[model samples]
Target: MSAESPPGLDLARLRSRLDADRPGLVTGPLSARLIEGGRSNLTYVVDDGARTWVVRRPPLGHVLPTAHDMVREHTVISALGSTAVPVPPTVLLCTDDAVLGAPFYVMDFVEGTPYRRRDQLDALGADRTRRIAEAMIDTLARLHAVDHTEVGLTDFGRPEGYLERQLRRWGKQLDASRSRDIPGIDTLRERLSARLPNSPAPTIVHGDYRLDNLLVDDTDRVTAVLDWEMSTLGDPLTDIALLVAYTEGEALGDEISSVATAPGFPPVRDLVARYTATSGRDTSAMGWYLGFAFFKLAVILEGIHFRHTQGKTVGEGFDRIGASVAPLVARGNATLEED
Candidate 1:
């Protein structure tokens, strides 16, 4: 045992801790890889020859205090354990920084594909594609339908002023990451502020919900809804609207839109209708919500663009992100004009 940790993980330390806390949890040696190390949090997969588990921790180096709270992610997932929502089972939660130099949690590994391309769904055929899309919405409805109070999540977040706070928060994020002026960015933000829709009764708002964020098994079942770094009690419509925004852009030839171009993924209108009927919430002001979603996404992408400029970003799509921003801000303004 050389006491050397593989890149992004102190496997030796992790193994020692697991052996001390829960003996037999890790049999044999351990290897880990940083699977998803993006804006929200860094995720890794650890395998012990026979069994595997997923690990989540804050991004290396610069970390936003409230953005990637391991305990918050652990808390929400643990709370949703009994709900119809399919989340990976928690194996262990370690908040102590000594074990891994940062707080992290381990959960049962979920086997599923996070469909991020229309071509991927196209291979599944239209029927299966539609089924998966429908399941995504149904699961979202089921999640929103959960009574937070009864689930002991009443204090998970302060739902009051959630939407307003979100607007201010993202605006600050954008300003902090600003490198250049984005056309129509301020206009879109101002319009969203001017016409803030009266939010419905708050439910769990998965801050960044979309197809790629969900894992669908071969049976077309959403085995787990991954990425709870942004989960909180807030206007549920924000989640739905972000879904619509991504699909809407994809349908318009936007590369980052990712899904919704398949033959039978169902129309955005149908999806909205399904959510309305399933969740029993009025979606009349979805246009405003969708526009707000666009603004939020534009800001997010711009922040990524800034990071990429500073050579702080990892991955391939950074070059195209700045190109995506102006169009999104423009679309956000246009979407608000809809009836």
Candidate 2:
């Protein structure tokens, strides 16, 4: 494998490792380019003219404990390869920092587009957009239907008290990233702590499930579900609620993905209806889950905001990330209040 690699990726060492571990995979010298639009992990597209694959590694600096877990990401994706869920086939998981200065994993690069803007969806027209949205929901249903035990992920995560642990986990994440005041954040956290919703039968939760995280083909099929950084065995409703929260659009501001605002993208009620019909999971508690989703999103955005403040983040969209935190906090509080 060999091109002049990016700052975090050493193409030469990667080529060496691939040759040693997965012989004959690389046909020529390797070249790699960082794939943008990912905020936490560093993803790069590596090519040797004959084949293409993706490499995922943790961020450059200021990584919070347990975040950007390459092993967990690789494990879950590898386990799900034979399931109904669409995932890129993993090549190898390299824990030797000597290879990439961080633990990383390689997967076949599925060909598809990650539509991050409403304009991009608008170009697809209303009917196609609707089909894409339906496909996205259908994919989620299929994922939630998978039995963790059957896939050898029985120890992946503690499903009991999953919602409670998620709240605490993101709370600690927020504390670790504190740099400025965020309105209603503390209130939202406290209220969330005061009343935790009961979870349904556990499923493999896609910690961040939304349109942009998926790669869609020209036929509107979701070819692959990317970004398993926070995936676990947990309440499937949380996934549905988070997807609903994303479809709310602009909660993270225009700089971030707002593809749901695109015309013909189904409404929240329609989204929930589709999920209910497909997954058959009761969404009666979605109000509370939506609130939790907002809180989680706020903490996530605030973490990014903190990283941006410290110049630890890469890519173009981080400059405006800080400004988006307060609104997310407010939205979270409001959602909980309504709930």
Candidate 3:
């Protein structure tokens, strides 16, 4: 075993642990590379010559409380493996930090493309792009339809007062990562707090549901939904509004995902209508949810910006994250005011 390894993963220790626990999973020495495009949790694609898997761990430093729980992520993904949410199959969950510096989990890697930019969708043609987007909406509807209790997720999260708790939670997350003043953020939060919309029946919500978080196969079907660090049992409408928010103003930011900006992507109203028609849930109050979605995204990017400033962030595109926060705040405020 060599002393050299990726920044966060020690290949020698990882191979040793996997051999001791999940024997024979790896046939050769482990090599890993930190996967890019993730702004919160650190993801690595590891291979052992014959096999490949994904490793998810927390960021290098400045980790906010309850933000990147490996057990929570592992549990939900494992639980949803039996459901129709299209999560990767769980291999093993290693809570022992002696292996990976921080808590991390391993899952078999699925084959698909996580389309991030508009150009990628452009190559797929308008009809294919429309189908992919529609498939994403339908997949989300299916996830919300799953019975959490039946799938051994009865205590995954508290559904009571979910919207209020989310508001408070993200607000505190923003405070935790505040390195510089983000103008209009406080006002946006206050406006969202003023009139909380009544949430429908709670379901398993992928807290950060967006196009790039999903992996699509060549046939225009959503093969898997990646990044479950923010998932829990909560208001399903939050997922819908978050998806809409991602597509709203992404054209202005270099690092922001612009998959929705591609031609033939369905508009917000069409997405909402498709979701409503599929899930039978009303989205009449999405105006406020959209505002909160922008607020949440702003806070997330601000946290990444803070991490980048502290030299705790890994991978590229982090330098451009801070510039995107103010625009999201402005959009959030405008959305709330319009509502």
Model 3's TM-score against the true structure? 0.97
Candidate 1, residue 147: Cα displacement in angstroms equals: 0.5
The TM-score of predicted model 1 comes to: 0.93
Can you write out model 1's per-residue Cα lDDT over 1-339, one digit (the tens) per residue?
Answer: 223454456888888877888898887777777664244466778888778988888765545436678888898999998999999999888989988888999999999998888789888999999999999999999999999998889999989998898898888878877889898889888888888778888898788888888899999999999888888999999999999988887744445655688888989999999999999999999988999899988887776777677775545566777788888888899998874
Which candidate number would show the highest lDDT if scored against the true structure? 3
lDDT of 3 by residue, 20-101 (tens): 8899888987778888888999888989878899989999999998899899999999999988889999988998877888
**Candidate 3 ranges with C-alpha deviation above 4 Å:** 1-4
**lDDT per residue (tens digit) for residues 1-339 in model 2:** 346778799888998999999999899888888888888899999999988999999988888888999999999999999998999999999999988899999999999999889899999999999999999999999999999999999999999999899999999999999987777888998998888888888999999999889999999999999999999999999998888877774645875578888899888999999999999989988888998998898888778878888888778789877787787778878888788
* lDDT for each candidate structure: 0.83, 0.89, 0.91
Candidate 1: which stretches are off by over 4 Å?
Answer: 1-7, 36-39, 251-255
Local lDDT at 335 for model 2: 85
TM-score of each predicted structure versus truth: 0.93, 0.98, 0.97
Q: How far out, in Å, is residue 27 in model 3?
A: 0.9
For model 3, state the Cα shift of residue 52 in Å.
0.8
